[model samples]
Target: MLKLFILLSKSKFGHPTVMFRLISRLMASNKPVLANTPVPVNKSKKRPAWSMYPKLHDKVLEKLKENQLNHTFNPKDEEHSALKTYDTNIMGRFRCYNDECSSPGWGSKVVAITIREFSGNRYNARVYHQRCRECEKVGRLIINKSSYVDRVTYRIKKWNGVNMERPKWEEYSGPPHDRKLCEGCRLGRCKKGKSDDE
Candidate 1:
């Protein structure tokens, strides 16, 4: 009986033997190489960039179409405005035209929009100024004339009188001290040493 079993094992019909016992053991431990089965895998679908600014483009167009007035909140509709609060954690609202807005700094108004065509990683929404038509046209013209330096400079300006006057200089220096100070630090850069304020 032992001789018969040895003869059957020695035959080449069952499966081919290979070198490296560990490799052969690993291969043998898996399922047979039948034609039907394959290993399974899972892949998560990525979210689109435009998904973040959902309906923004449409909202702007709709507002424009209706010719909505700027700077005033309408009980009936959504209009363009600067973002005063963009954070999810804070319990506050952000008007896009608010002075603290990081983009397209236009003016301080709750219902006024101060953004146009802002881009994200995968998408962009056209932010717009919510001023009247005349201001909007002039704003665009200035944007066109401005150099890169000036364009960036333009986004920053006085917002809700936060830095209306330097605390120390407000009383002594008086109003309209220097256009340079206003132009250079439209977003409050005059207080050079007070790094802690930011």
Candidate 2:
């Protein structure tokens, strides 16, 4: 808690927490200081349990790194299966992680995680990716023909098809196409067309 307050205060005010920490280290190491007026004490704040795990994130990062090395299952994980990878998409649970999926039902989504492997066994990364909501699977690769280029590649990504309840200048326009197609984009295109004529 005290350390977090110090960190927060130090970050906000550009105060020297590192110097203070160094002074703390020096005091701990029995370094002598001049007997002048002592350093002013800073107020400390208590941090929540999740934030105060004492290098928990570092430990997780270390384990993730070790998993990259040796390519072996963790002996410490006695309970988990030999294959420990997991994802909502692989299990075919495309629903959102939110709890309130029942009352209004869920907007269907295809959610999955992707792991990129490397040869040197140093930096492996796991990324959680959503199967495009519209396509209901991982995104698609599209190829467009360009007269100038041999091949042009584009990616079609699935995005949530939610309708946002915002007012728009589309009041002057007719019925809309796909609802997620923003009114702002349509209005901007129309405004540009009119301005070009004027």
Candidate 3:
């Protein structure tokens, strides 16, 4: 075995030096390389469970859809406090991250919105999307129900399916422009039509 090891080491079979060290260790130790060692535990910390998130998400979506039937309000309107806040804070505020467009990082425009009202006339807007005026890409925006007077403050939970900074409005940027994901752009006659050359 020692002669064979030496012969192998001097040949192309031992091209890798680590193999020689391992083989030498095996020969010198006179025992199995894996013997008696404790199995390693993957001590990765478990994330806190959001068990109710799915049900709550479905409920919110259902409520938003139901409210959409009668709760249509122009995002550009500033008469209603809730709608006004939505307009100023969310609509035409987010910057698009799409590089395909001629002007990436340009602020997006509100294309669709849904609102749900609560006690004391407080409102929560969900399923709202902002479309880039340049490339016509869409990004989802969510507004939380805080208080009637304080509803003006919004936290962006997600943008285009990504977790956002959640605090700063100016930091709110969106996913890459995708016309296919935008209904107005997909169906044609987007707020701003594509250039004639394309």
Candidate 4:
């Protein structure tokens, strides 16, 4: 048997058939030979049971549908320019109605208004008021009307106690002329012509 093993090893039978024959012969001899090479055992970790598919709730599905409908109806509405400056909590800048204020106006960074319609053409709308930063410094106060829809006829009260119906402007009216800035320029927090350097 040793002579046969030595003869098989010396022969250059590199084909798979020769290897299979050698393995068959070894099995037939009834004497098992231990291989020096270690057999690789897979040590992969098992996934947790909680990682299975999740169950969806009816309310969640309804909410997702509503959101999809809203987005499909008016995609631009979600991309309102005001969102760039203010979030829900922070106030942003707007153009001052007072052309001579020489300072930037004050407004909410994000303006979210909701209008509800009822029977008989009656409607309820949410309005937001933004005061001019420069005007506030003086005794006078200027408040601008902001609405969800365009050209809304809303009542506004002036400093002189005069009530007037004004039309709301578009969400974006070109670029705001009175943009808030540092305390140096005419449109900043500082007084006109007075900077921190002086």
Candidate 5:
């Protein structure tokens, strides 16, 4: 049988098939086929700490921690009661405004904060800011007033410092501004225009 196998392996017509069979048999014998090869073990690839918006990521974390501490201290404050908390883990998706480009919208996280008595205002006013994963590469920041919630409140005192009325919350009736488009779209547009001119 060994002579016959060697003859078949040596024959030009059956050489490939016989060699394949022999390799398969050798591999099935429970010994490592690549015994001479050095295999790397326990080598893990490290992911980056931040994919985009490193400064924004740190700022958001700090703000969240501060808000949590402040909430604990002023649990009963009416202003605190009106504060709205957004899910920081939830990412926002926005499409590129350039119609010619096939690039899909980027993902981002919206951070909204309302500071009470801001700049001597009677009520709490909210500001909206966004940290986009794609736009951050080009150093573009997304800021707009469209997402603001204009809640106005005032205090009234009467007669010997007696608090006649607490701060009243009123909803803003004005129409919201249009949402800002992606800055990447502008860059795409400029490139397209230059190509056309060329």
Candidate 6:
């Protein structure tokens, strides 16, 4: 039997049925291909990158500790003013979820916060959006928004007043990215113009 198996394996142009049987028998034996090879042990599951932002917030807060604002949070401020107030000075980490993009994320203050306004002069819901820095750097040729992926978990790393708390990884529970309201989305770089021939 051993001689027949070795002959079959050594045959250059062996029958398909004999080759298949030899391969199947080898796999079924459960013997290591290499001598004294270590068996692979199961590794501990790791936490997702997004889930670790609370700890990252600590490190990022150290960078943004001094850039505090005393101005009250307002929903009706002018768009530019609001963006400056909420996004300009702070540090934000964002991940890119676009297809074929391998960016883990980037840390920048390019966040856009929207405070929704309801009827009867009511204002609520702080919606946050962030752009992928890698995508922005790459610069796409077609007319498309700058890969503004959502659901960036944020925390009040430092609280100075009422109406806020040190929430643990508060995932953004707001509306989707609005291309019309996005400055990056409105830029000419993201748009394609018609040619004279057209």
Name the candidate that leads on TM-score.
6
Model 2's C-alpha root-mean-square deviation from the true structure amounts to 21.5
State the weakest 10-residue window (summed lDDT) of model 1.
Answer: 85-94
Between which residue pairs do clashes occur in model 3?
none
Backbone clash pairs in model 4 (N, Cα, C under 3 Å; residues 3+ apart or in different chains), count? 3
lDDT of 1: 0.24
Query: Across residues 8-70, which tens digit of lDDT does each residue of candidate 1 receive?
Result: 345432222211222344356674533232322223233111112233334433333343312
TM-score to native of every candidate shown: 0.17, 0.17, 0.23, 0.21, 0.19, 0.25
lDDT of 4 by residue, 19-84 (tens): 446656666868755553221222433311111001212222233334231111111222233211
lDDT (tens digit, per residue) of candidate 5 on 1-198: 344345545554254543555555555666654533322222333322111222232333333343231111222224445433221111234443322233444434332233332112122233223323333222222432222221111110111133334433333233231123323223232222233346
Model 6 weakest 10-residue run by lDDT: 188-197
The global Cα lDDT (0 to 1) of model 3 is 0.36
Better of 3 and 4 by lDDT: 3
Clash count for each candidate, listed in order shown: 18, 2, 0, 3, 0, 0
Deviation of model 4 at 57, angstroms: 32
Supply the TM-score for candidate 2.
0.17
Model 4 residue runs over 4 Å out of place are 1-93, 110-114, 120-124, 137-198
Better of 1 and 3 by TM-score: 3
> Could you tell me how far off, in angstroms, the CA of residue 37 lies in candidate 2 after the best superposition?
53
Give lDDT tens digits, candidate 6, residues 112-161: 33332233422222323344444432221111112111111122212223
Off by over 4 Å in 2: 1-69, 72-89, 94-111, 122-198
- Pairs with steric clashes in candidate 2: 110-131, 132-158
Worst 10 residues of 5 by lDDT: 150-159
**Comparing 4 and 5 on lDDT, the stronger one:** 4
Model 2 alpha-carbon miss at residue 108, Å: 9.0
Q: Candidate 5: which stretches are off by over 4 Å?
A: 1-103, 106-110, 118-121, 124-128, 135-198
